[model samples]
Structures are given as structure tokens and as C-alpha cells.
Target: MVRVTSMAMASLLSHITSLSLPLKPHLFLFSHSPKPTRTLSFSTPAISQNPDRNVPSSFNEDIGPYLSCSMPHNNRRLKVAVLLSGGVDSSVALRLLHAAGHSCTAFYLKIWFQEGFENFWSECPWEEDLNYAKAVCNQVDVPLEVVHLTDEYWENVVSYIIEQYRCGRTPNPDILCNTRIKFGVFIDAISSMEFDFVASGHYAKVVHPSGDQIHKDSALELSQDTVKDQTYFLSHLSQDQLKRLIFPLGCLSKDKVRKLAMEFDLPNKERKDSQGICFLGKIRFSDFIGRHIGEKEGVILEAETGDFLGKHRGFWFYTIGQRQGLRLPGGPWYVVEKDVKNNVVFVSRNYFSVDKRRRLFHVASLKWLQGLPPNQMSQLQCKVRHGPGFCNCTIIIEHGEDGNEDVAVVHLSEDDQGLAAGQFVAFYQGRTCLGSGVILESWDDQGFSVCAKALENARMEDKSLLGKPVKIKVKPETVATESCQLDGMVLSNQRPCKLST
Candidate 1:
């Protein structure tokens, strides 16, 4: 079976960064200064070295209870598929798993990136990343498989991202890519293989549904490495995906992982962490959006006095509460509203100028883990965006006119801002990531709407929700719920989903 290895500092460091600081997690306990390069050495562990390897003590003893050795692959080693992203985290992931005595194969999924836009922007690192992944596989003594998934990625994740921006909504493409591309489509391709599970370098944990309950509805939880936890991206994945997946580096800190790369002498050890979109290299978000949406010049007006702020790219390029890259003079401005029909963007110097703090919003296209979590309305923490962190909220289930569970009305227990349509809201109970939904509408005392066309056709979808209130009604009335089930387990027993005869 494969094992994980992280952190091999010759000596522990001199200082520690504050937890309050929003910086990437580091494993080296040293001063912020760079340390002298040290050569890392490790004796390769062959199958003959030790038939039953004792897990390293540094990985923590507590994991023993959660990841006990009594796995299904009792006599045989697990056939694990490791996703190599050509970064420090994934590179080290392969080493850790291979060392643990598991049979491993590495795969690099090539995705579609607008490489033609290289003249205006730098070219993406697809070729370079592939080479790095290959080198890592060689060093780890694992065979590598390269899968070309450009067409599938473009059709599902990329197209949806462009469409959302074109229609004037702030969409999280990473969430879609994780759910549809990595776990969803990728799983289909591996169906013919004899692989037992898939592994990635994501800093997240797959746990029993609830603490000490590993029955059926188990979900992914935040990693011990909170600074770089990636549970938010994997929020929409299904329980089946979680069942066949493992994050080898989930419990290790980033700095610890990096040090292991150096210790194992793995390729890409010094490779800088990937930034921005996974495949899209280093292009600015606005520049990337401008490429697809094209440039639709509009007037930027001050929300307070309707004073013209400046000429702006199409209102689609800006999201509510955006403060950077505004190019507007006389000061910093935050986007508050978008007039899609007239092609105008409203900005303000004050954050709460257009609306008061909002606590309630509506979410459509709700996809739950193992189906909707007990329909009883209750408090759960949620994150509107990947970076807004999380806030306490009470989620009420809403049903359509036909009595089928349709959407969710999330009432933020604390005041929050910048709620937008097309963005995902990831729900969480403590550290466990429950599920997510798309923002259909958000409201407050202010009369702004992110996707409602009634206010000015912000979301240019075919059906028009004219005259509909943006603020969802929270009366806590009875709402019909959808049935969620799988062949092996039933998500809920209360509502049985009708099968089409």
C-alpha cells in the first residue's frame, strides 16, 4: 500500500507565523529568512524491505482511528490513481503514497486553455507542466498516463464559465471544474480500469458522514492545513466520488509537503505554487474575461450622485464589490450594481452606500451531498465565495410551485456583503463540507438584483423573472423535498423520489 511522507527539515525552524495572518501554511518552523540549501536523502522502500510497513509517526497517531489499517484491500495493495498537477503539492503527494507501499499510477489531465491569446497574454504552461509531471513520475518509479480532456473540459466547465460572464453573473469556474471535470468526467474514463480509488494533492479530508459514522453519506472535510484547505472547491462533489478518493497530503501542512519534496528529492520541489486559474497560467482575471466577453465599453457612474466616474469595459467584466483594477481616478471604488440593458456600472466610495448589510438570499440548482441534509431548517456555516471565509447561516428549504424541492433560502446569521448570482455558496457544518448551490438571487433593504431581469435584465437568460422580489420569503412553511438516493444507500427515507415508469 502507498504511504505519505512530509516534512524533513534537518532542524526545526526559529519562528512561526501568526494564525490570524492570511498567508499560505508553512511547515518549516523558522524565521521568515531563507535557509541554506540542505540535501535531502531517503532510502527507497521496496516491497521486500517491509511487507507490512508501519506508518510514520510524524503523520500523527490520531489518523490511525480514522484511517485504520483494516481496509478492504486486506491482502493486496490498493491500486491508486494519482493526479499529478505539476506542482509542489502533487509532486510530493506521489512520493508519500508510493512510500506507503500502495501500487500507484500517475495521470496528467491536459485541459483546454486559450493559448492563442498568447500574443496579448503569455502562453499557458501545459507543455511545461506535462514535462514536470513526467519527471516526477520517473523519480517516483511510477508509470505515467496522459489523458487529453480538452474537449470535455471546454464543453462542460469552460463553456459554463464564459456563458455566466456573458450573461452578467459572477461564476466560480473552479467549482464547476472540480465537480464536473476532475471527479465527474474523469471517473467515467476510469470506469473500465481496475483502480480502487483516485488520489489528489488537494488539502482536504474525506471523512465518515459524521464523526464516528462512516455509513453512507460521508463527505469531504477541511484539512488540518487550514491555510491551504481546498474543501471549498470540492463542495459540489458527490458521496460516490468521496468514497473513491483520498487526499494524501490533506493532513500535512504546505510547508511540510514542500520540505518532503526536497527530502525525497522529488522533481518540481522548488516549483512555485500555481496561481490564478489552474490551466490559465498567469493572465489577469479581467483580461481573461475580456478575451471571451469582448470589450463592451460602458459608462462608470458614481452611485451617490450619478457622476460619471470613467469609461469602463462592459459591465459584465465587473462583479459586485470589486475594488481592484478599476483604473478610475480620484480614488478606489467598489462595484455596487450593474445596469445590463443600458450598459452601465455603478460604483461607490462607501461599501454600504447602495444597501445595508444583507443576511438573506435565494439559491437555485441546489445539489446536496447524499441528497438534501435532513430537511429540518437549521444553522450551518457557509462561504459565498472561495475567499470570503465562512459565516453562520440558517438555510430554509424552498419548493417550487409544483411541490418539488426547488431552491434554498439562506439567511446569514451574521451580516455579509457582495452576494452575487452565478456564484456558488458552499455549506459547511464545522469542518465537514456538506454541499453547494448557485445563487439565484440575493436581497436586502437595497433594491439591487444580481440575476433578476425585472430590475434591468442583469442575467440574460431566456425566462424572465420580472417583478419577482429578490429577497426570498423566510416564513418557514412546509416545502416539498426532492428524493436523493444511490444503489448502495438511501440519502433520506422521508421522501421517496418517484421513478419514471
Candidate 2:
């Protein structure tokens, strides 16, 4: 059996003390037999330094309860392939598994753009990421392998994203990246390696069946860190993928993970969390879209009045409910709809008006982890996007043209403004993830057809008023206060107004 010597423990304690960390004594205990059995127990409770954060009491629980099938047991040393992303979370994850007496092999996936796309690849920090991943693996004496999945990523994930955007739908690339690249192709690439499991720093728990429940399928659960839970992205994974996966940071919060990184003195301890799309690195989404889709001039029209507001690069550059980059005057404008055939974008100042109720939508291409939908379809919680928020929803099964139960009509208890086609809505029952489906359509309950008719009528009226004298009756005292010039067009703050044609 191998053990952490007293001197080693004293040195670790001294390091923690020098950092002024409020950690209690005897935080970790390991028991390694001929077949290496280990346990990680934390006596000190995890407390959030930020009181504004709403963390559950379970955050204080030790890591042992969440290990599930990831840890070695009954004198068995498991071989794990850990995915290191050169971030603090994965670095700490590698350290934990190595310390648990597992034979760990670290893999850094190289999926960045190719050489010809240097304009898009220039900002990618993949080289820096690989360096950090190598340093972390070297620190733990683990063999590191670089797996190049660029072709697979582009063919599967990148193409899907581009096609979805071109069709004027908002697709969640992260979700597709997980299902198609990370766990899908990456699993196939390592199939002959005989690794027992594939692990990542994903903040979600996997409950593999054991004991009397060995016949049941493995379940994915929400991590202790609600705000950082990544089940939304992994909800599209299949049962086979779920069974072969392990998440070491599932029970630990971001705060606790940072503390562990400090304790371990990892190479990427000070690295900030990566944001935006996984493959894009520091490149702007607009720039990438422009590079591929190549913008065309389009007109922006007001949904209610059909007034020519301004010009846009293209209709594909915007999504439903997008409020940024519109740059319209007279008020804050939001993207309400898009006319793809006409290359026209519709905007409105009162996007959240009382008439707009985005509570109903249709979801297709369903992927349930247990190979079946939940028995209680009438009640479920769903997330329209990846965040610490869930909406009380009910699912009504619908049959497709082939008479298969392939569509689900979801009705949210409250209205959501960000609902869009091609976005994956992750369903949940308490802590267990029930799986997810792609949104087929977001029902526009705001009388969009009526708005379109109004736009047509406004266009006809404008044609009639052309080349005719227009009279304006404005209160003399309020003219200076209420009227403003925007892009050589006069706009009034009062009602019943007309602009020069």
C-alpha cells in the first residue's frame, strides 16, 4: 500500500498556511492496497465567500459521495483517459485521478481551424493550451497524447453550425460539439485503447448503476455547482456515451475547484476560464460568419410601420431577440423576426409588449438518455439556454408525418424572450437530466402575420404619399424638446407623426 507520508502532509499544510487559506486539517485521506483503493474526504465545509451567490447546502458535502463509478473499487485499478483543455478545472481533474491511484493518460484534442483559415486561426491559443496541458501531465507523471480531430470537427460540428445560421436559426454549437466531437468521435478514436472510461472537467455528475440496480441505465445529474452545471450541453449525449464518462469536478463548486488548483499548484492555476465557442478561441463570431457566408446588403424594417430603419450586412447575421448591434435611433430596438427570402430583418421597439407570449414551442430530433421519454410528460423543467435557470414546462407528444412520436410540444409556465429554432432545450426532473431536443419552431403568439400585413399597408401608404406635400403640426414649445434628427431622418417623440418621404 502507498500512503502520503507525514512529512508530505506537513509540507502541504505549510503551503496552505502560507497562502492564508481557511482549510481544516486532515482534508484528504488515501488508502491504497495491492489493488489501489482510495478515498478523498474533506472535513472542512465549503462556504461561498460571495454571499450573493445561491449555493445549495450540498456544496459542503465531500467528494466521495459523487465519485460513483469513476473511482477504483474492490482492488481494481482503472485506466482513465482524461481530456485536458489547459484550463484550471481539467488540470485539477487530472491531478485528482492521478492521486487516486488510477493509471491516467491525458489527451489534448486539437480541433482548431486549418492553416489556410489563418485569418480565423490567428487568435486561437491552441499552442498555449497544449503547452499547459503538457506541463500538467508532466507534473503528474502521466503520458500525454495529442489527438487531432480537426477534420471530424469541421465536417460534423462546424458545418452544422454554418448551415443552421444560413437557414436563419440559432444553433447551439457547444451542444453539438459535445455530442458529435468530444464524446462521439473522440470516443471512437480511443475505442481500441482499452481505456475503462473517458473523463473531462465537465461540471456534471454521472450515476452508473450498481448493486441491485445494475440493470438500470446510467443517469446524468446536476452538479453541486448549479451556476456552472454543464448538463445542458451534455443532454444530447447517448446512453452509451453517458456510461463511459466520468466528471471529477461534479460535486465541487468553482470556488472549491479553484482552491484545489491552488493546493495542487497546477501549471494552469491562474488561467482564466475559456468563454464563447469552444473551437473559435478569441475570434469574433461575426468575423467567422462573414468569412464563410460573405455578407449581402439587406434592409432593416420596422415590424409595425415597415419604415426603412437602416441597412444590415445580412439577415443571417442576426438572431431572434438579439438586441445588440442594431444601432437604431429613437429607442432601443430588438430583432423580432427575419424574412429570409427577402433578406429583410424586422425590428421593434416594443419587443416585450404584453401581446408577445413566447410560452409555446415545438421540439424535434429528441435524444433521451434512457432510450425512452419520461413517463410523466405533463410535468418537467427545461432550460432554453445554458445557465442557472429552469422553466416549469409541460410536454405534449406529437406524431410526425410518418406517425412516429418524434415531436414534443413544450409549453412553458412563463414567457421567454430568447426562444429560437435550432436551439437545444435540455429537460430535467429535479436533479436528473432527462435529455434534450432541438427546437423546431418558436410559436409567434404576437400576431406576426398581422404585423406583416400592417407593414404591407404602410408600404402602400408610403407609395401614395410620395411626391405629395406633407404638413406637420407640432407644438411650438415642444418642437425643440421632442424632435431629433437621426441619420438625416426626422423622428418625433409624440404620437401621430409623419416623416418627409
Candidate 3:
């Protein structure tokens, strides 16, 4: 674990200025003056704590019930390979596909797990997981092929995870791993194996079976189980990848999946789900990385005044807006910032925002799924996290001052707190997903800095959609706040709307 101190206070504070937006009044309940000199102390929990040590491994069982029973395209039989993990969901999907009369095969990706991770893999060892996948093949009577992807997994996923942490960016390894390793490497292998499509247990739906490049035309819709939808972690997948992918569990709920698993009487039907990191199950993420990334104790302080609150194990382990493991004197404290180079964790109660008129926000390596016009991108909803709601935003796209051709800036309509540099900012339109980008820079003022890489990929340009009619369902607040005069009004891109103020 990393820690912070007074010397490094300026670095974090320099990035955070005050914004024009009025914050909660109780924000100033603590120190009013900025005191970067004061220091705080905190105690952190061991990083390797495992919550599911004695749980039985759900691997080594039949996996037919967790999948959808949809027949593959008849002519070709749609030779498909399902990424089986010996988990209930994947098993169910496997069973469903086999019952649908599709030529299905199971591919279990065996990656390297951290040392001593065996405690978590009890009952269902790695071999058991693989055998369970094989067991499913026996029941469905489909050929099961297990491929060893340790080398690719290490080089791609593990290396990338380490690199991201070394750079102070909290990388979502699962997303990147899926894109680069699972879908990239594994899919590539399956392609050569002559599999028509690759299937998984992801709960996301892809619309339009044909005639769409960006998939915006073949929009990716959220699954029925909004809570169980894993699309957020999957937005990084390419349109081509999505085309050959199958999500048999997209339409089913968790409860429904369990019921089906029971009906199929699969070996792991009653098996519990795997939790924690993907490959390094049950091991605390911080602990797993702590071994590789050396840790040093640092100061934890109150964001208001540099008042010493507690000590932290490592800054790299914790993220902004985290509320646990603070061990502070007050009831509870939230992490507002992490100083990686100097080592510090900034803590704050519910309210402690600077009222200055300037702030900064940044997005790095931004990729756009659709080529929406600048006007549309600016006018759409922008969400920074996985919360249900969103914020109305106005994007001011601009070139970087330093003349970095790949850099751009997007000014939000409001100043948001707990903005981190490495997180993602996804753009959406109603229930439809437009695209997303990375957080390049974050500030209290100056809006957010975004990179240009992903924006290009996210562009959606189809002339046919230009004149298509779109329904506009305004929120009650939008209608109540302004008087509607239909003489000249623009609804859902339709123009000629005049409103009386």
C-alpha cells in the first residue's frame, strides 16, 4: 500500500482548484483554510484478505442450464465456441446452445493465478474447473477443447495491469483483458479453429444482425437485468468483435438462469459464483499487486486542512471516492485523492469542496463508438460512473495548448467532485450508448481534458439516419422549468420550435 505526506500535498492540491458551481453548504464543516503542511495518519487492512476461503469450488460440473437454448444458423450450423469458466452462467449458456442443435465447443482459458491463491480455488481446483467444462461437454455430448492461454494472458493482461499501475492509472484489467486477450487472442484462435461465432455469458444485447459497421446502427442495448448488465466493462470491444459474438444470457435474469440450471441438473447447477479478480480469485486485488508494486506508508490527511487523519498502506491500492478501510477517528472518511509519486491519501467527510471559481477535468485516450456531430456530443448525457442517473453536459471541444494534436478538452455543464485521471467517461443518449473515453486529466475547474484516440472509433456517420424521425421524451423538469411554445420548437433533432420564456 502507498501513503501521502505534507511535501506531496501541493501536487494533489495543484490539480484541484475551486469550481463555479455552488456545493453543499456543510462542505466547510471542517477546516476552512487550505493547510498543505498538516499531516494525517491511518491504518489499513491487510491487502490479501479473502472473503470466500471455505466456499466450495463450483467447477467440475455440467454447464448446460446457464445458457440460452437458441439454435445456431441452420445452413452453417454456426459452429460456435463458448468461453466456459466452470461458472454457472457460462455452463448454462453451453447447455442452451447444445440443446439448440448448434455445433458447440467449450474453450476454457487457463491463466496464471497468484501464488497461494489455491485456498480460494478449493474443492474446484483449476483442473476441476476445466474438468467441469468437460463434464458439460459429456452431458451435452459436444466436443470440449481446453486451450492453455497462460503465456498470452501474462504478456497481455498481467503486463498491462502492471504497466497501468506503474503509471498511476487504475486500469480496469477485466475490460482490457476481455478486449485484448479473451476476445482478441482467444477469439483469434477460435477464428482459425473455423468457429463461426464466439459465445459468452455476458448480459448485453447487440442489435441489428446485419448492415451496420459502428453498431450504433446495430446498437448494443442493455440486458433485461439492468443490475447484472456487464456492458460497462465491455464497451471497449470493437464492432467487428461484437459481430461474431453471442451472448446467450443477454435476455435472461440471474434468477431465471439459476432455475434453468436446476432444471438441467448440471453438476455445478447449485455451485456458487466466482468473485473477486477474474483469474486471481478470492485474493484481494491490492494484496495481489502489492507484492509486485512495493508499498510504503504515507500520510492520510483531511482535504480541508492538511490535518493528519491516519496512515495508509499504499496510494495505488485505493481509488477516489472509496469509503472503506480508512480507520479514521471520525465516524467514516472518504478518499478524495491519491498522491502516487509522493504517497498520500486525501480524506474528507461528506462536505469539503473548495469554492474557488476554477476547476479541471480530463479524459485520456478517448474513443468514440459513433461519429456523432460535435453538436450532438455536446448536447447528450455524460456519466462518469456506473450510477443509474446522468448529468446534462455541454462539451466544448478544443485543441490542447501544448499543441499536442491528439489532445482535446470537454467542458462539463457542472463541476463534478471525486474526478480521477484514469477512470472512464461514457457518453449516452437515453437508453442508447453513444460511446466512451478515458480520463486524461481532472481538475476543480477548467472542465476535463480528453484524448482523441477513441473519439475517432466512436464516430457514427450514416446519412440514412440524418432524416429519420426520433421521438423526444423530455424529463418533467425540462418541461416544468421552461414554458413550451410549440410555434418554433425542436424535438429530438426536429427543428422550428419557439418557446416563450
Candidate 4:
């Protein structure tokens, strides 16, 4: 309904560039790239276009099996609150639930940038999203409510994100958005309405306890679409939250959802999937951080040797395992560590060095969906980020001073370069998501803490060296590719080492 033209988009980007704080060159390049358009067309049998018409037999035959397991056991029509974004997945989800004979109310959350952040708000097409959401709800005669949770989002989610970044930790805001707002505050907001359940387009499964298993807690499982599965984001949800939530697209793949969208003839059937952190929308993350935290010039140094390499806007602008924006000659460099106190970032060519084992990490503030830790903690699958990949992990429960289970020491079967403090590690046993915990710090296999202690020592040494001016002529050194033997295999394809004097 509110179409943003290509000219308008380009103009908006130009305005961003005209701001007092210019974005990084690479970020500017990324912003200038053309956005992809979705042009899918299907010739499937026509389903009834009328909202009042009964679902076609063909529709039932196609999607019936998937819904069979998720539908109400009593076969009773229920009042459902559906979280509708203007995306195709959510639109198709609303249609599926409508066909399932449930009374549905659509809610479009107005949690975009609040006032005073008009610049960011203008960049995000939330008005278009809301318009599309309204169109989808109107198609099915479902009443749409615009919930203003901007204050709550800023207080709970946005504030936490800023604090985490300020503390030099990479936090996953999407995971918090699902846990704190979508399921947390939204549920409380509509509690007085006494809706039977809340539903969404998330690609994750929630299996409610039934029959004799009614005594057991609701289980969160992976979606049929593994690649699109969103359990990582939903991992922090409590058992109560899972019990009251419904994910219609859990059993459906992305391709199947697109087909359903065509069959339903929904207004947003051709809408492309939204990307990046939900709140930021089209705004570059660097620009967002720059606006909030601002920038301070910091020095980049080699991790093994304290040789200066280059300068960065700020240490907070980069993250571990990052290989971009370093603008240094010689070869590719990876961010290995950060000296938060000194505002310094450390890099290395041999990021995957055997000496720098990232297999072990400590996680704090555990949230178990089942109300308790899993019985089988030794053999579990864990994800450090939102993706299909899962690393086999074992948990060593650490007790607090009061003898309560306080921390979880997770040992990954393999090393993860991207492991960062404040990131959530969602654990899974088979299809069921046990829950997740925040990574406190990481360590090497030798039991040496790699993140905190190592960085602290570097920070202290740098502090002593600060304010003492010394001019030293630096010479470039050519080092051969470093190789290591792992599991009886030699890894000799490592990047050529770049040592600075």
C-alpha cells in the first residue's frame, strides 16, 4: 500500500551520507547496492479468494498433514492473537490459521525507532510494513491492532544492546527481542483480553504437552525447514511462553510457504523476507552504533607481537572473527582480541592457530525452558549463532558460592572463531531446545582463559607503555604459511603470516 520507489530509497541513502557523521567507506558501498526484487509466480489450483468461503479441499490436502500435529486436540475454534509482520511468512501464517477455523486478531508491533531518532525511522519502512499487515488482516476480516511498545523495547531490548556493546561484547538483539518483547511484554499486554493463544510466523515448532504428557512441560523443537529454523532466537523463551505460543510455519519450508502464499492470494504474497536485526531494518549497523556510541580513533596491533598495524574508528566497531574494514596491506587479517580499557583491537593472520583453542567457554545466566537443566548434558548440540550449523557440546555445571547451579562450562567439539562474550549459546538435545545461556568468556584446551585474562594482561602492559613517546623504525617481515597437525592431519593452507616490527 505504501510502496517505496527506487528513487526514494536512493534519496534516503544520499540523505544518510549527508549527515554530520559519515559512514565507513565499505558501509557506504554496501548501502549503495541494489535491493533484490521478488517476482515469483505460481499456477497452482485456485483456492477460494473469498475470506468467508471454506478452505478448498486441495488446500487441506496440501497443508493438512503439517497442521494435524499442531491443531487443537479438541477440534474447537479458538481465539488467537497473531503477530503479523508485513513479510510473506507471517502473511501466509495468518492465512493458514484462518483456514484452520480459528478466530484471529492481527497485531503489528510499532517498536521502531522512537521520537528523536527520526533519521533512523525514516530509513526503516515501518509504515509500509504496517500497511501490508493491515491489508493481510483486512483480506481475512481479522481486526488489526497497532501495539505501541517503543518505550518498552527501548527500555528492555535496546538499552541492553547498547550496554552490551559499550561493555565490548557482541550481543544478539534478535534473541532478546523474541524473549523479552514478542513473547514477554506482548503476552502481558493482552493478558486481560484472555486470548486462548498467541501465534507468529517463526519457523520453529512448539509441542504442547497432551494426554498423559500434560504433566510435562511444552517442548520447543526445530522447524521442518532446518535452514530457516529460528529456534536459536526462540531458545530463551520460558516453558510458559512456549505453551501459549503457536508457530504455524514450523512444519513448512520456505518454498512451501511461498507456494501457500500464492495459493492464498494474500496481499503480501510477493514480499521479500526481512533481513538484518529487526529493529535496525535497512539502516546499516555501523551507522546505528556510530549514532549512539559515537567513535574514538583506536590503534590496531598484532596479537602475538605488540607491533602497531593500523588505526580503527573504535574497538566496539569490530568483533572477533571479523576480517573486514582493517584496510591494512600485506594480507587478510582477523580480529583476535580487543583491549576494551585501552580502546585497542588485536589482529592476527593465523586466527585458527592451534594455540588459540576456542573450544571451551563459560556461560552464565542460564534459562532452561524445561524448568530445569537437561539430564543428559554431556551430549548436546549447541549453536553460538543463528544458523543451521550446530556444534556437539558438553556441559559442566558449575555451582555458585551458595551451592546453586550458577554457570555452565561448555566444551565444544570444535573451535568457533566467532565466540564472543554476551552472545547466547542455545543448546539442543535432538529436536528439543533445552534452552540457552550467555557466554561469559572463552578459554583454550590448556585451561587458560583466552578472552578476559589474556586481554587484561595486554591492557595493563599497554597502559604502562602509554604516554611514553618512542620512535622506532619498522621493517616488514615475510613469514611463511604456518601449519599445524590436528587429528593426524596437517593444515598447511593457512594465510601467510604478516609480522610488523
Cα lDDT listed for each candidate? 0.61, 0.68, 0.54, 0.70
The better-scoring model by lDDT among 2 and 4 is 4
Measured with C-alpha atoms, the lDDT of residue 123 in candidate 4 is 73
lDDT of 1 by residue, 1-501 (tens): 222122322222222211121121111010123223322221122212223233333443233332332123243567988888888887777767777577887877887554466563346677788778877766546767665656566756666667666767776767777776678666655655668878888888875433245575656777767757788788877777778788877677788777777766665878888766665665666677787879966666666555544667788877776666677654445677777677777765555433555668888666677676645457578877553256777888767676333678888765554666676788887777888877764455543333322233333343122232233223343333333221111212122212111
> Global CA lDDT of candidate 1, please?
0.61
lDDT of prediction 2: 0.68
TM-score of 3: 0.67
Give the lowest summed-lDDT range of ten residues in model 2: 13-22
**Candidate 2 local lDDT, residue 241:** 88
Candidate with best lDDT: 4
Alpha carbon lDDT of residue 487, candidate 4?
Answer: 12
lDDT per residue for candidate 4 within 129-229, as digits (tens), equals: 98788777666677676666676678667776776777788777787788777887677556656688899999998888665667788889988888788
User: lDDT tens string, model 2, 1-501?
Assistant: 224323312222111100111121111111111211212111111122433221123334344544644442334677998998899988888877776677888878888755567565667799899888877766656776666667667766676677777878777778877877688767765665678889999999888776467678989998888878899999988898898898988888899889877767676888899877877777777888888898987767777766666778998888876766887755556677787766778777665555766778888778899999999987788887776778888998876666443678898887665566777889989889999987764464543332755356334433333233223223233222232211111212211112101
Mark the 10 consecutive residues where model 3 has the least summed lDDT: 486-495
Q: How close is candidate 2 to the true structure, as a TM-score?
A: 0.77
- Would you estimate the TM-scores of all the predictions? 0.73, 0.77, 0.67, 0.79
